[model samples]
Target: MAQQRDPRGSRALKELGDRGLYWFDNTLARGAAALVGWLALLCLAVVVPVSTVLVWTDPAVPASAPARLAAVWRLTGETLRLGGKTGPPLRMTMSVLLALVALLYVSLLVGLITTAITDRLTELRRGRSTVLERGHVVVLGWSEQIHTVVAELVAANADRRAVVVVLADRDKTAMEEALATRVGPLGRTRLICRSGPTTDPALLSLTNPATAGAVLVLPHDEPGADAEVVRTLLALRTLLAHREGGREARPCVVAAIRDDRFRLAATLAAGPDGVVLESDTVSARMVVQAAGRPGLSHVHRELLDFAGDEFHVVAEPALAGRTFGEVLLAYATSSVVGLVRGGTPLLAPPPDTAVRADDRILVISRDDDAVRLEDCADAVEVAAMAAGRVVPERAERVLMLGWNRRAPLMIGHLRRSTLPGSAVDVVAAGAVGIDRSDLADGPRSGLLVTVHEGDATRPEALHRLDVGSYDSVIVLGRDPAPGDPAGEPDNDTLVTLLLLRQWEESAGRALPVVAELADDRNRVLAPTGPHADVIAHGKTIGLIMTQICRNRHLTPVFDELLRADGNAVRLRPAADYVRLDQETSFATVVAAARRRGQCAIGYRDHAAVHRGLGHGLRVNPPKTERRTWSALDEVVVIGA
Candidate 1:
């Protein structure tokens, strides 16, 4: 009796309702056919009742039940767009069949359109579409240097409507977002990202490298990055060979490899037009150079980046037969550094060498605009020019704060450049591995080597070394452990810098320090005195690679400029080139340097060194700009 009561019956009906809903949901999940059937039944169940109510409620409807039922059937059929015939059954069946066929046709057309659009959009999202731009810059891979390269390229093309196409094995949207964040606004240049393995010939051709003005192959920041770069270069060569114009269609190629062993292989793969640089060697050389000269990196920053004065190659047909010494004073605004003859850069060549008819002179200028070729010879003040005096070399001392695989290379470079009796004290946690016999074995017996076992990151270790006695200090980041894939060596480097800064403060004087950083972004976090320089290895290489891509003739120019044994850019006392404490024009300085067999390009004001204005470094200043020469000012010149 209790089970038959209202409460019991209501509970039983609720359970049945829940079970029915569950079954319906399961059927809907089965497939689209089941879903369509359920949808049709649901429309019928609702529309038929509503149609029946309307027919019954209307006063003009027939009193007969069959007539009313017929009216409801017509109403429901019309509402559902099936059919609305009222006379013969066969005619009604034909109308319904025609309506069903028409509905099916519309549905099929809509589905086809949607499917086609979706497929096209998917293809675009996958970044497989071929770029149609001509004379564009094509970047073949992604790396830590991508941001710096792209930013510099954009700055270089600021006056023109240019495009940079990046082809890498990364998501297109992600690459775009990352660059937008890191590289900031690209101004007039447009950046296009494509996703694919850069080593695949088919995918590489999608970038349209044949029509590109230049192609830059960036190495990945990993153990086998050089290998990947080599393979990509090979694939690129293969693709270009099969293209319409074959090798003639290939653009100028520039690539960088981290390991020296892979440089020759990469160079061979890149062919005759490609320029390959060993990044580690270049960076080690730069660090050594910076350690020797405190403000040299700032000068290089001005030279390498596009935002400042940079190397430009221009032709001067009228001055072809003039001696390079006469050509030096040809332009008042631009500074001539070398001449490119037969595609070779002769930097700081003998002043008496005649400029060939086919030669193009390399100048450091603010832009690639046309040169007016005004003579600045009249502006030269011979009275203010100082007589040249040869400075004698002296033995020095150096302190190295850390160690890595590149340490040996740095030591070797220092040995080549340092004077005899110079000593290098290396303070780190491991044995320096460099032997005294190695230094003695060299042709020039320079750089007495000493290694102390201590953690450079520890303050006690830094304090024991007296921290500031050496002429200059070099801080290198700890090398990544072997086989440790996710190691971050910059953390240790930062700690060492922090402690070094503290020690420098305690010593009560400035230290000419040069620190090596792995990541460019961490350069801001480095702690040092006003005289310190932080060299990000990847950024230095990237800037040089971009510069090479812009002009292939600059390969030998940089080779001669950065190495220790050749003519290099140097900062000497202004008194050596001009009369100090007196107002003089840059032409007088240029004339003074010419007398000493050097090229005067710019100057640095020591008074403005720590004022946050590029360390007071100026490159390629106009010859007409006259200023009072202070005793502390330095003349930037290129010489042996």
Candidate 2:
């Protein structure tokens, strides 16, 4: 029948079908498409062969081959549908059993698919997604300074839409929680947090450094933080090199190096346009400067904070060709402190120095938009007060309490600033030692140094030192004991401050005391007396880092101001610059300082200092305004 039709070809066709099935089963077990593949295999393996066997064994089944195939198809479909009214009773019973098995297999497949989806979601939350934002500020690494930096950036861009993305080798949820607690609300700034190793190039890309407006590298407080910062810079450089347009199209980078030794290396890694700050040297110098002037810490804080008056650079064509002295009185609501020309900052330049057309005036104001010049029609007349005698430099006795890593640097700075015959006495519970050999051959070789071991917080130690005899007292914040929290250092500092205040009260004489603090929050706990000058270490460093990030030109200006051999910030007697108890314009004071080869920026009122208020430290005062001075007042000047 039909020429005994091709038995060999039919057998070959059957064998090909069997081989295809075997291949499909293996592929399903290996590939991601296994779920659908396994489901198909399960239906075919359980229903197709079983349906064929049942129809062939049944005597009532169709006799022809096509009829048998149709019966098999109907049975397989009925099994998947659970049961059918038109099917034979026996066939329907069998369909129910096969349906239960299929249902069990489908449940297993659903469970596996759900687990796969959950794993992907978890990975995404771990900060593996690529960022698509442009012009955002990217902060690399995490440290205590992050809160201050973010807060400052938020305040700086409060009126505009901005984004700040933080990438660190910390838990994403933990970082977000810390930020939420420290920074309560960000008005117009959007904050994003990602968790990854900051030194890894691939991980660094998660913050999209190529498109960022600026990248800030924060140094950890632990040992070897400088190395970590340097590594991060290198990683950023690598990413920049691979960017679409290369280095020129890369974002600006700013980094802080705790150790001065690594500054050059960090700078190289950051490229010529990037900024690398020497944080240790900056903090030491600031502490020394604050120690010399009792109320200087407050002045630094005001200049560094965004909530108060901050430094801003603005171009003013109308001010071009005018003298620095004339431009000082140009702004009604702002104070011109210096001039920025060719990207270099010149603070308190000579009064005769002319402002160029391309120069930008560095002004202290509430905001950049608020820097406006007004007509000087209502300016007060400049009256030359009778000149007073210059005060002679004299040697004095000083007392230092407590000790830390910064003690030696502070001592060296003290030596450089004080007269040769001056003496410094250091007392602390721990071993207080410094290399006095270097001082032996310097100009300050004559300065005396004494070290004593005692608990500074005790009443007996205060009495033994005869605190009132010293011209000034410096209390350095103590390091916390092992296992103690960070705030403990500040707590000890506060206690020492209270004891000093008591000592001054009992001695019935105001003692000039400059107290160093580890945390800014403890500043409020300090006694509200003129004798207590509180300087927060963390706040000072935070402000410096923020300033460098905002403008790199300030680095050299700060270095010069804080260096021992360069121009320094000094509070000399007001009488040395101008006559006392007579109304005189600041312009006359400027002239007097110029005569001495010094630059006068402001003056401090001794009366205000005695009242524990900072209203006395008047910086960038209007040049045409007339004010009376006292013998106790000090003129703020930048001098040799």
Looking at candidate 1, the ten consecutive residues that score lowest on lDDT are 432-441
* lDDT by residue for model 2 (1-640), tens: 5567798999999999999999877886787668766777788799999999999999998799877887887787777665432356677668767776777788789999999998888766677677889999899887657888888888877789999999988888888888888887999999998889889999898889888888999887667789999999999999888886564566778888876689999999999889787765666677767654676666676677777777788999988898887776677667666788998888777778999999999777777887778854245333444454666778878888888767777777777777778888888886545444533436435668787898888888877877777888888876545555656777767778889888777878777788877666677788735745787766666676667767767776666766755666777788887777888777777667765656666778878866756547787666676788898888877766
Q: What is the C-alpha lDDT of each candidate?
A: 0.86, 0.77
- The lowest-lDDT stretch of 10 consecutive residues in candidate 2 is 377-386
> What RMSD, rounded to one decimal, does every model reach?
3.7, 13.3
Per-residue C-alpha lDDT of model 1 across residues 132-159, encoded as one tens digit per residue: 9899999989877898899999999998
Q: How does each model score on TM-score?
A: 0.90, 0.78
